[model samples]
Target: MTTNNPMRTFDDSRRWATDGTAMLTTAIEQLDASGIAAGSQLPGWTRKHVVGHVAANADALGNLISWAETGIEKRMYASTEQRNADIERAATLPADELLTWYARGATALEGAFDRLTPQQWQHEVITAQGVTRQASDVPWMRAREVFVHAVDLGTGLGFADLPDDFLTALADEIRVKRGLSEDDLRAVSGSLPDVTAWLAGRPHGIADAPELGPWL
Candidate 1:
């Protein structure tokens, strides 16, 4: 999927960020119409919690972008506990406020990315997992946050709700993450619609294989 065009990565990243914000906006609107409360999902967490977490991740990435640009290490948070507390605080906001904050956070992130030079995209940053990765991976990471947590909210939407190109790219990414080869993906092939379901840990056509957990 390489392109001869320069700035392809930047263009793809910008598009991903824009599309992700639109999806989140839609999800929040649906949540409002459905009258779903914050505490609708996992124990001790609500729809607000999920939204807040997504916002927090955007904020973190925004900070990382700033650090990359300035050559100064602006720590995203004091600690993991602080990050979790920030999410909790954001979650306590009213549904309207939380949704608005999520939108603002996404916008802020995109703004940070827009300021980056092409060379800065590949600048190394240490991840929470202690692995170093390119700054360009930030949008993809945030996309996973938005998309997967959208599913966690149990909105009944899955990868199928995304563009087919996005789903195919995501499936390829997941296959690599799960240590599956191209042959493995081909062996269990059915339809493009099933790829999302299979990636989300649902049993589809392949019964003998171990249950696929959430890889994104």
Candidate 2:
């Protein structure tokens, strides 16, 4: 599998963010009118929960971008408790407030990315797990958070809702992330509907499910 080209990755990130924002905006518009208050596909998470998670991720990625620029290693949340607390705090805000915050977070993220110099793109940053990655990985992370969580909201959207190029890129990423050989995926090829389905682990007929869930 080919590693994502930096320029392509950057461009894709922008597209993903733009597309995700559009989806979220539409969802929020409907949600506002319907006053639908319910949990989503993620266990115990309401629509609010999903939006909060996406917004929090945008803020976290913004911080990571700042860290990359400053050459500082930022620690991920100290614990799941802290992480959940933050999400809950954001989720509990008034619906309109939460939506505004969510939009602002994305706008801020774009602003931050716009300011990054070419050299900064190659700068390495260490994740909380201590794994180092290129700064370009930041936007990819943001894209995943926005796009996946948008679907997780149980808003009748799926990977199929994504652009073809985005789906293909995600499929390639999923293959590598899951350590599945191209041959392995090809061997079970008939089972999978598309790259997105394979990425979601809902490959048409593969019954032995992978340990990882659809979150990836």
Candidate 3:
């Protein structure tokens, strides 16, 4: 059931998930009540909203895992309105309880990953965007969420603090998603983290790069 490419294996997915969660946990741990109430990098949301959103995202991904493993059609959320409402409601939790929710959701997601069989990893699941992809893609999906949202928390962490390999993977994935070719934009280049940030529509003050549209 193993592949010649290690990156495609379940072990590699687990590694990415583990590393991403650790980074997110650290960021969450650093937030104080006042810090949680402060506006985050996200346009109108507070740090509490970002944390709650991340926790909900973990639960959503866990639903996809169940869909793959059980051959049942589990929707990521009931609907977008429900999802937003859930985040807003969760964001009201006290800072300590919010962190506890995040930790619990993350652990449940990891357990879901562990339950996946090799065949289940290849099963198709639909994202909230209605795009269908194999379950194997979930790890990188979660990685992108965690890494990007950690920066969104605005707790002194930035894209620069992410691991180089994660940044590289994120950049490559974003390029594919956005239908970007090297020639599509101005010839902008940087370290992997900076490139990832730029591609995700964060301005890095790198002149000559084409102005990118918002990623989300």
Best by lDDT: 3
Against the true structure, whose TM-score is highest?
3
The lowest-lDDT stretch of 10 consecutive residues in candidate 2 is: 1-10
Tell me how far the alpha carbon of residue 105 in candidate 2 is from the true structure, in angstroms, after superposition: 1.0
The reply for model 2, stretches above 4 Å from the true place, is: 1-8, 33-36, 76-79, 189-195, 201-214
Cα displacement (angstroms), candidate 2, residue 55, comes to 0.7
In candidate 2, what are the lDDT values of residues 1-216, reduced to their tens digit? 112553245767766877876776677567862342577777777888788777877777777788767777665555668778978886678888888888888888888888887777778776645677777777777776767676777778766676677666676678777778777666554322354565665322445544446544
Error of 1 at 93 (Å): 2.6
Better of 1 and 3 by TM-score: 3
lDDT of 3 by residue, 9-90 (tens): 5455567778878988888787778988889898879989999999999999999999999999998999999999989987
Candidate 2 vs 3: which has more TM-score? 3
- What does candidate 2 score on TM? 0.81
TM-score of 3: 0.90
Cα lDDT computed for each candidate against the true fold: 0.70, 0.69, 0.82
What candidate 1 gets wrong by more than 4 Å, as runs, is 1-8, 38-45, 75-77, 202-209
Q: Rank the candidates by TM-score, best first.
A: 3, 2, 1
| Residue-level lDDT tens digits of model 1 in 77-156 | 56889888987897668777777788898888888887888777767776655656777777777776776666667666
Residue 157, candidate 3: C-alpha displacement in angstroms: 1.5
What's the count of clashing pairs in each model shown? 3, 1, 0
